[model samples]
Target chain A: MIALLMRDLRLAMRAGGGFGLGLAFFLIVVTLVPFGVGPETGLLARIAPGILWLGALLACLLSLDRILALDWEDGSLDLLATSPLPLEGIVTMKALAHWITTGLPLVIASPLFAVLMSLPGAGYAPLVLSLLLGTPALSVIGTFGAALTVGIKRGGLLLSLLVLPLYVPTLIFGAEMARRGAEGADTTTPMLMLAGISAGVIALLPFASAAVLRVNLR
Target chain B: MELEVSELSVARGGIPVLEGLNFRLAAGHALILRGPNGIGKTTVLRTIAGLQPPLAGRISLDRETMTYAAHADGLKATLTVEENLSFWAAVFGTGGIDAALDGFALRDLRARPAGALSAGQKRRLGLARLLVTGRPVWVLDEPTVSLDVEAVAMFVRAVRAHLAGGGMALMATHIDLGLDEAAVLDVGPFRARAAQEDHFDEVFL
Candidate 1:
C-alpha cells in the first residue's frame, strides 16, 4: 500500500501529473470571489466561509479523476488488482494519497485564501479546522465516484454529477461550522458532525469503491 | 504446482463468448492459446488470471497465483524504466530488479523515463515487469506485439527461463514463441453461438 501511495505522490510531482492543478484552481476561484461580489467587506466576510468551502470542495473534485483514470487507462489498475494487495487497501491508499496531495495543501492554503475574501478574524481557526476535518471526507467520497466512473470514456462530467450530491452533507456541516465560527457562535455541533461524516466515510467507503472497481474491471 | 481449468466458460459485456473450455498448465511448462481475432482468447486468459469472474466452471489457481500482461503495458509515462520496475518489485515484495533490467536489456536505459523509450523499448520494459512480479504463473496476451526480431528473441528467452525455473505461462498469440515444450489450445472449438442473448440479463435489453 505504501508503494502505491508513494508512486501516486511521485507521479503527481512529475510533469503533467496535475499535482499543482487543484491548488491553482483553488487560488483562482477564491481570488475571483471578491471581484464578483464587489468590495463590500461585510458581504465578503459573510459569504467567505461558504465560498472557500465550495472552492476547496470543487478543487478537490477537479483532480479526483486522476486518482484512478491514468492507472485504469494504462492498465495499471488491472495489474494492481492481481497483486497480493487487497482492493480495499488499494482504494484507501488512493484516498489517502489524494488527501495528502490535494486536500492537505488546500488546508494549508485556506488561511491565505480566507484573507482574500475579507473573512472575519475570528473565522480563520474554525475555517481551517473545518476544512482539515471535512476535506478528507471529500477525497474519500470522490475516490468512490472516481472508481465508479473509471471505465467510462470522458466520464468527468458524470463523475461530478454523481459525487456532488454526496458532498452535500459534508458541505453543510463544514460551511456551517466555518460560518458559526465567523459569527462567534457555538461550533461544537457542526464540528462534531463534520468529523463524524469524515470518519464514517473513511471507514466504510473503501469497500464500496473497491466493489465498484471490480465490476468495472469485469 | 499445476494450473487447471475444467468446463470453463467466460463472457464479455453479459454475453457468453466461450464455453466448455478445458486446459491444464503445470509448473515448468507453457500453454499457447490460438484462435482468430474476436475469438475470446483474451477473455479466457483474463478469466483464468482472475481479473473477471468466470461465467461458469472452475479454475484451480487462486487470483494471486498468476500475473497478467496485455496490450496496455501498465506503465507510467512520467516514471523512468528503473522506477517503474522498482515500484512493482516493491508492491510484490519480490526484491531487486537488476535481473529484470538485464534480462530485458533495459540496464542501459534504466534512467530514461518510460515515455522516452521507443515502442519496442517500452514493450521490453513492460515484459521486464513479469520478472519482478515473481509469481508462479505468467498469463500474457500477444506479448510480442510491435517487437522486432531481436526483442521477440528476448521475450522467447525470458519465457524459456521462466518455464525452466518451474514457472508456468498461458499466452494468446498468433506468432510462434518457439517454445517446443509448450502445448497449444485452440479456442475456435469453444466459441459460443452468435446469440448475444445467452446470458440471463438478455431479457433487460
Candidate 2:
C-alpha cells in the first residue's frame, strides 16, 4: 500500500504531474472573484465563505477524472485488480493519494486565497479548519465518481455531474461553519457535521468505489 | 499447481460472447488461444484471470496465483523503466527487478522514461512485468502485438524458461509464438450463438 501511494505521488510530481494545476485553478478563481463582484471589501468579505467554498469545490472537480483514468487507460487498473492487494484497499489508497496531491494543496492554499476575498479575521481559521476536515470527503466522493466513469470516453464532464451533487452536505456545513466563525456566532454544530460527513465517507465509500471499478474494468 | 476452467461462459455488454469453454493447464505447461479479431479471445483470458465473473461456469485456481498481462502495457509514461518495474515488484511483494530488466533486455533503457521507448520496447516492458509478479500462472492477452522478430524471440524464450521452472502460461494471440509441445485452443468453436436472448434485466440491476 505504501508502495502504491509513493508511486502515485512520484508520478504526480513529474512532468505533466497535475500537482499544481488544482492550486493554480483555485488561485485563478479566487483572484478573479473580486474583479467580477467589484473591489468592495465588505461585499467580498460577506460572500467570501461561499465564494471560497465554491472555488475549492470546482478545483476539486477539475482533477477528479485524473484519479482513475490514467491507470485505466494504461491498463494498470487490470493488473491492480489481479494483484494480491484487495480492490477496496487499492481504492482507499488512490483516494488518499488524491487527497495528498489535490486536497492537501487546496487546504494549504485556501488561507492565501481567502485574503483576496477580504475574508473576515475569524474566517481564516475556520476556512482552513473546515477545508482540512472537508476535503477528504471531496476526494473520496470524487474517487467513487472516477471509478464509475473510468471506462467511458471523455468522462470529465460526467464526473462533475456525478460528484457535485454528493459534495452538497460537505460544502453546506463547511461554508456554514466558516460563515458563523466569521460572524462570531456558534460554529460547533456545522463543524461537527462537516467532520461527520468526512468520517462516514472515509469509512464506507471505498467499497462502493471498488465495486464500481470492478464493473468498469470488466 | 493446476488451472482448470470448466464450462466457462463470458459476456460483453450483457450478450454472451464466448460460451461452454473448458481447459486445464498443469504446472510447466502453456496454452495458446487463437482466433480472428473480435472472437472473444481477450474476454476468455480476462475471465480466467478473475477480473470479471464468468456468466456461468467455474474457473478454479489457487487464490492470487495468476498474473494477467493485457493488450496495453500498463507503463506510466513519465516514470523511468526501473521505476515502473520496481513499483510492480513492490506491489507483488517481490524482491528485485534485476531479473525482469535483464530478461526483457531493458537494462540499457532503465533510466529512460517509458514514453521515450518505442512500441516494441514498451511491450517488452509490459511483458517483463509478469516475471516480477512471482505468480505461477500467467494469463496474457495478445502479449506480442507490436514486437519485432527479435523481441518476439525474446518473449518466446522467457515463456520457455518460465515453463521449465514450473510456471504456466495461457496466451491469446494471432501470431505464432514458436512454443513446441504447447496446446493450442482455437476459440472459434467457443463463440457464443448470436440468437441467444438478452439478459437486460439482470445487467441493469
Score chain B of each candidate by TM-score: 0.93, 0.93
lDDT by residue for model 1 over B1-205, one digit each (tens)?
8899999989988878999898888899999999988779998888887888998999999666689998889999999999999999999989999999999999999999999999999999999999999987999989999899989999999999998999999999999877788899898888876544455445776
Lowest lDDT sum, 10 consecutive residues, model 1 chain A, at: A13-22
Instruction: Choose the strongest candidate by DockQ.
Output: 1
lDDT at position A177, candidate 1: 100
Q: What are the per-residue Cα lDDT tens digits for candidate 1 across A21-51?
A: 8899999999998888898999999999999
> Relative to the true structure, how large is the alpha-carbon lDDT of every model?
0.93, 0.91
Q: At residue B202, what lDDT does model 1 achieve?
A: 51
TM-score of chain A of 2: 0.99
Clashing pairs in 1: none
lDDT: worst 10-residue window of model 2 chain B: B193-202
What DockQ does each prediction reach against the true complex?
0.80, 0.79
Candidate 1 stretches greater than 4 Å from native: B194-205
